[model samples]
Target: MFLNHGSFGACPAPVFEAYQRFQRELERQPVEFLALERRLPELLDAARERLAAYVGASPANLAFTTNASSALNAVARSLDLGPGDEVLLGDAEYGGMQILWAYVAERTGATLVHRPFAELAPGPRTRVVFCSHVEWTSGRVNDVAALCRLAREAGALSIVDGAHAPGQIDLDLEALGADVYTGNCHKWLCNLRPSAFLYARPEVQDMIEPLVISWDFHAPSFPERHRWQGTINPCAYLTTPAAIDFQAKHDWPTVRRRCHDLLAAAELGLEPLTDDYVQMRGFRLEHPDPPELKRRLYEEHRIEVPVFESAQGWVLRVSVQGYNDEADLEALRVALAAEL
Candidate 1:
């Protein structure tokens, strides 16, 4: 019945219980559970190890973050941007990131350049090349490896926003070769909310400065520096391993393939924007008013989807997750016919 996995992800019942279990343990013994000298570091390190193996990175170079936006802020804010320096970004970057980068550029006197996501070309003044592995707007997967290579060849840092990638697609961060990468474990991976990671290559780890100068400020490594951010719940981070296990036990690859096929069928007459999408597809909406269509679809017919204006016009994106099926698509179809 739920098709908006991209907007908000849900944890499987087992994973949710695991998250709750961790929370209860923390609540019962705050100091013993959260104190660094005790179980907190061990739990986080184990979680990081599992996640690092899942995403293809070293635990030492990986840091847990609240969300992708916060992770990117840590990187973007730490950079010593100055006048004439450029932060090249994809035109279809997420709206939240657009605001974050705009603030960073405004505060640092750096130029933020927008280029096509698929065919980004870095210039001489480019200091950083930022892009999304899977675009949030169109649900199209960009060639992140190629983009990272291009940024490296340009002598610039490559930063990827992978908020939508983690469990949606298989990842090998080392293979992708980006200077910095951030992804959400809650989405697709189905952990809990606000759980994500930031990856920096060992050589470039020192360049990263924690957004908050906390207890770990004098810690020896990048992960240690960003590991403890003051009394924050570690339940979501600790439950990520269980989320990874849930996918493996359920054979998510097969489920994803099935979802992709269902989405393809749903996109048949929807004027699909591109074939690059897997589980999620964006359709070109000819509706006179996109806002009205969106409201009517959800409020009247109970079809929850994103229909909004973008650079390419009004778009309606349909997501096919393991929980979605042909009936959901059929319901959406019936609703669209009635409304349009």
Candidate 2:
């Protein structure tokens, strides 16, 4: 039973076929598929248009990256920081991103503050107000739209880490009003691995500097500056439309509701971190070793879920996708009951 779609999503058969089709085409003629501007550029532009429509953003403002981390790093690095500047983030952010901010603060003379979302008050020196739309650790949903309003009031830029938001919740980036936002298509969207997009508001697009000084950097459009970082595969990127179409064709909204109800029915006998979660739920675990519990769930029970220690404590995070059903959650409950 797989219950960890949030960690890395499971792509559907049809979408994976489209992704593979693109890869095979790339191999057929590397120069024409990759190097030719008319071929690769037009294809990427069309893909970006479809994704932008889905996320509620313009094509010129969205840029593709391997994952949300890289997308956020691009935004994090582009910001001009100094000794007195500060970058504020939530205490319950993704672990990898916590390390990312630490690295940035060490390199530049700036302070990184971690506080609860409600307590995030942008001060004079607060250059960036960073947060996650759906927290990775506690599975709590943050009101990032309100956070953006606060940031604007304080004259600070809002950057949202929306890694788990795309398919799990409806997104309207323009209305969400985050100065910068990045989301993972590979997560809730059920796209291929390592597909994500970073959105910078038109007003702030000029503020973001290109991470890679490649051949496409000189393009007049700011978003196009981020294109063609290397010879890295664009097959996953090309399948965005197919991924979106897959969800739409399956009546995903109804499926999501069913999964959410199924997950809610699981009797884990553990305290929930929050009641605001959707298809995924985070439970407080008191096990002596969280990693050991994770290993036992997988090794002994043949169940797949994420059990790790975070600032929040030993967290047992269970995710429910359209593929998940009552049996999967029941198996997890049984396995967890035995361990506890």
* lDDT at position 117, candidate 1: 86
Clashes of 2: 0
The lDDT values for all models are 0.89, 0.89
RMSD of each: 1.1, 1.0
TM-score of every prediction relative to native? 0.97, 0.98
User: How does residue 261 of candidate 2 score in lDDT?
Assistant: 87
Per-residue lDDT value at 102 in model 2: 88
